[model samples]
Target: MSVISAIFVVLITILMPPAGVFAISGCSVDFFVNICLTLLGYLPGHIHAFYLEYVYYDRKEQNRLGRFAARPAPGVYSDRIQSGGQGYGTIVEDPLVQSEEGRAGATGQ
Candidate 1:
């Protein structure tokens, strides 16, 4: 989490227990509060709603810009469009998890 996010969580904890729960769990306030209010059938607190799209897009843009500004090693892509290397295609795919049985066998899952 970013420093600003951490500070925000701290502030939430100081103000509202439910908000603190959402922040600490790394969940969006919208979903959490929505469920709570729905169950109670009443309006909830005045906390700001989370904007997933805005946050996601902003972060993605930052990483994309970082790619070009930062040089990546050969054969290894950073997944950032701006500063990655051509050797690795500048992107690294996350590995899939294997089941216990698959891990024990020589054949790939």
Candidate 2:
């Protein structure tokens, strides 16, 4: 995330805890739950916001590392070549023959 976004998230979490959690989670259930917690008390809302932040960062890091690990290395060719194999040959079928056969079958001949 950008520095601006990080600062915005921190500010929102501290000032408006429930909204921060909702923005991070983007889940209706989490949003409503955080709102309820905030209504009950500020501490609960802050705690939940921190938890959401931790989860978000954890998942983000995991995705970044996963993508890095999954990429092929430089100068690597991944395709495999078939050895001593005859390349593909076209098998042709006449459309006129197929149509005539269809007509004969339709006429019960």
Candidate 3:
């Protein structure tokens, strides 16, 4: 999250504790619960808010990394061009592949 958003959340929590907690949790829980928690103790509400933020950010980061890891590496193809073959076909030449091909051609391989 940006610093502005962090500051905004902190300010909201300090000014209107219950609303801040509710917003931080994406309103997944009852507003009354937040109100009760805030009423019980300001620190408890802040703690819950921080916990929710931690979980939210952690999950977001995990999802991003998961997506990145799920993608095929550059110059690698998902489908084989020839059926029943274990080798991958070169639809587009990677820089390494291009250089290797050039060397092979020069060597008459």
Candidate 4:
């Protein structure tokens, strides 16, 4: 949101908390919650609206989880930290398992 829009939202929030939340978010859960809270008390509604609009705005609207999560958009998986390659998170086969299989094959079992 731009500076003017932000200021307008804040002013609306002060005057009518539910309206402010509706402006920030659409007919979402937050908007409904704001309505309920406003009915309950102006202070509670105002507080909740402020927290939603400014603090927890979540501009991207993507995963709330941290960066380790899978990419939402399709692209070359770049896991430079761990595997250090541009590919999907492929699991490395265990050396012990490979050795066990080789021994079993030698016995023809």
Ten-residue stretch with the least lDDT total in model 2 = 78-87
lDDT of each residue in 1-109, candidate 3, tens digit only: 5446656867787777666655545444434555667789988766655554444444444545542233322321212101111223544445798899999999999
Whole-model lDDT, model 2: 0.59
- The C-alpha RMSD of each candidate to the native structure, in angstroms, is 15.4, 19.2, 15.1, 13.1
Please, what is the whole-model Cα lDDT of each candidate in the order they appear?
0.40, 0.59, 0.52, 0.61
**Which residue pairs does candidate 1 place in steric collision?**
67-82, 67-83, 68-82, 68-83, 77-90, 77-91
The backbone clash count of each candidate, in order, is: 6, 0, 0, 0
lDDT tens digits, residues 1-109, model 4?
4567778988999999988877766566667878888999988898888776654233222223322224322221212211211224666566899999999999999
Largest TM-score belongs to which candidate? 2
Query: lDDT at 69 for candidate 1?
Result: 28
Candidate 2 structure quality by residue, lDDT tens digits, 54-101: 555544455455422234223212111011011227444667999999
Better of 1 and 3 by TM-score: 3
Report clash pairs, candidate 2: none
TM-score of 3: 0.46
Instruction: State the local distance difference test value for candidate 3.
Output: 0.52
